[model samples]
Target chain A: MTSEQDPRPRAVIVACTDGPLLVRGEIDLISASGEAIPRTRKTVALCRCGVSTIKPFCDGSHKLVGFRTDPVPPADRKRDEGIVTGEEAPPDAERSGA
Target chain B: MVVCAGSQGVDDAPVRAHCVGMNAFDWARRSGGPPEILFDARGPLSAHLLDVLQRPVPESGEMLAALLPATEIALSQSVDVLRDDDIQLALFILYGLHYGQVLPADEDWEWNPSLITARLALEREFEKRLRSCVPMPALPEVDSDAVAGALFDLTAPDPGPSLSRYAAKRATPGQLLEFLVQRSIYTLKEADPHSWAIPRLTGRAKAAMVEIQADEYGGGLPERMHSTIFAGTMRHVGLDDRYGAYVDNVPALTLTSLNMMTMFGLNRRLRGAVAGHLAAFEMTSSIPNRLYGNGFRRLGYDTNVTWYFDEHVEADAVHEQIAGRDLAGSLAEDEPQLLSDIMFGASACLTIDGWVADDMLDAWSKGLSSLRVPLAVQSFATA
Candidate 1:
């Protein structure tokens, strides 16, 4: 969490369509109860499709579960840096921060 | 020792003398190593290729002369080229030349025109057969998300009599060893076939591939490399961990699985297919790996034996995303024309590997060994 003054390190989480949410950058993944998630790899796919046997981290269970987002095609998804995402984009000034 | 061992193709003495320059008999005696020669000739092409690798390649002119007849004979005789053990083995050996330690041939032989000619002759037939066999999937719009979505769908887990499920519940210890033996052909050389595509790609796609491969390669820890981890699992299961140790045991279909990747990877024209192949491969890996690990655990094996599969459970979770979106998907975004080939590559992987799995499961269900050679002895089993 960022202080009132200092900004949080911008972590981009892309909610991949019919798939897990891919979180990039240095992230301190944790549970709702504040338990820290152990991560070995830098970028992680968090289980948005709750059926993943491995909780928190995805093991690609979404396809079997038929996870879907909006019916809108990917062309409408906002582009951040180079990655096109299903989520809304940051403000133009914030996009320029990188 | 396994490096020098090509299983059965060429004569141990001459090939070793030619390649390693050791007194083959003495080295054999002192080391008590695995059989370190080219394979026993399975078919005409393989017989001819083994013969070529045995001889020094300055004799390529003569090698070429002898090879053409065999290549021509094999090509002419083949109907279902995919299952032709002779041609597949020949291709496997040819590609093995690029990955050192599998074939005991001199370095000069890799680029020898005659060998390339033979490999290409076989590959053209093999590629033709593959293209005919697996019709390409419908092309998605050339955007990263669209392409990635298509790849994800193509690779989604099947709801059927699956090999992983069979392994998890039914396979015996002997069957487990056979599983390792069948898998040894590819798992030992993990990430290598696809790594060939790294230099072929550029920008986000290339970077994405590099990212996934870096993890596959153990992130600078050589011992932790997926291939090394696989080798460790082999050692745990009391199987030979050395590369090509089990090449003799696997059937043509198993070789075809790897050979397909090599064909895709080695040819720049099929670069998109290779990317898609890796995506489908990674996409399909994690969940099955979980079941595969459970299969070994059901047999009462410890973590040492299952770590390779366990590692894949997490590693490929991350990899599938990169491979689906950043690699294959991004590659499609860059080269719109390659989108179709990319889908073909993914389908071909599922089709070929699906067949391989069915072969194993059917063999197991029949109470038989899946490997070409029934594991006659468990070397690590204390009698």
Candidate 2:
């Protein structure tokens, strides 16, 4: 069967805000040296914070260190900085380069 | 309502005796031993309930009429229902019928309407007391991320007296055994109470719950099941691995901890609370489990004994994330009305569990046994 026609659901990785990235479905977890990381659970949480006692997987140390993440979407963040909307750009006459 | 032929225990003795006589005959024909009494009844309510459950249900009038009044008297007499031995044990027995094998009685008694009525009466009061005493946190906006954030904040590590810390640093070997016995009330059954919410949920929330529960059930490997792993830990530590083996020894608050979860899970309206409870439960687990394992290791116990705690350290880390965001957060987003209940459930879990911990720490601090009846004297030989 074609990839699209495959009956099984594809893997999903969710970036949980202020928390680890939750991975679901069947996916190979590999190390920097290209060796497989032994994952025991079907769904696993990969550490987003660098301080986890168990690296590559969260041991919930994020809360202890007060980790955080920007909740805004990247595109929206850029827009907010006036990259797209130009809401805070210099006055029209001052836009000499344009 | 399957009514007994008589209203009073004294009046019903002859009929009960006849029923017990027949049951004994059938039991003897089928087995080498008499039916095992599962637990010691704490008071008249539990005592009477246990007596009636052992025999066949009568074909006639009100057998459990005494249960309602007994429950009423117990509730009225007890100052705090949560800590009251009789009320908690009676509640535990009634809830046990649903869990199965908890009471060695006629299976038909599981659905006997009178028992159900008495259980409902006790549950009504139990829930009322929990609500009255267990402080609820402020509700977050009806959004998944917001809900998750609120729960994480609520369960954030606090500087209170921690039982796990005591287990790590100061608990005696005997105290360690008490710890295992007290926890065995729920940990041996593990993820079962929360699984009741599976059919009650939908979409993202349902899938999230199943994912966590699947892991809790040991990902289809029986030996790896959390409960099985817990049992192995119990056995390695020289305690009986059978469920309810230590029921008679634990205080009411220990039973109350499990009873709270079952109550929330079994009631459809409290599905949100169960989800939130699971989230908070997972959130608080990873760190303490690490400490618990350390305590056991400090006492020279090996991987076989520490494996349960070590396993939870990783599993609950994964589970807390899923429980917080995918399960509780998504549920709040989907069904906004349950948001408060979800918060209530999470807060209640922390409150009751904290009390249980305090109970143990209080006893241990005083150089006393945490259990209602201390375990029989035995050597805890470290490997």
Superposed Cα RMSD, model 1: 9.4
Residue range B17-108, candidate 1, lDDT tens digits: 33232323334445676335634668767877887787767665675688877898888998788888888888998998898767677778
Each prediction's whole-model lDDT (CA): 0.75, 0.77
lDDT of 2 by residue, B84-110 (tens): 888889888888778864656677788
All candidates: TM-score: 0.84, 0.86
lDDT of candidate 1 over A1-28, digit per residue (tens): 3556657655778787777788887777
Give me the displacement of residue A26 in model 2, in angstroms.
2.5
Fnat: each model in turn: 0.23, 0.26
Error of 2 at B62 (Å): 4.9
Q: What is the lDDT of residue B369 in candidate 2?
A: 84
True contacts kept of 2: 0.26
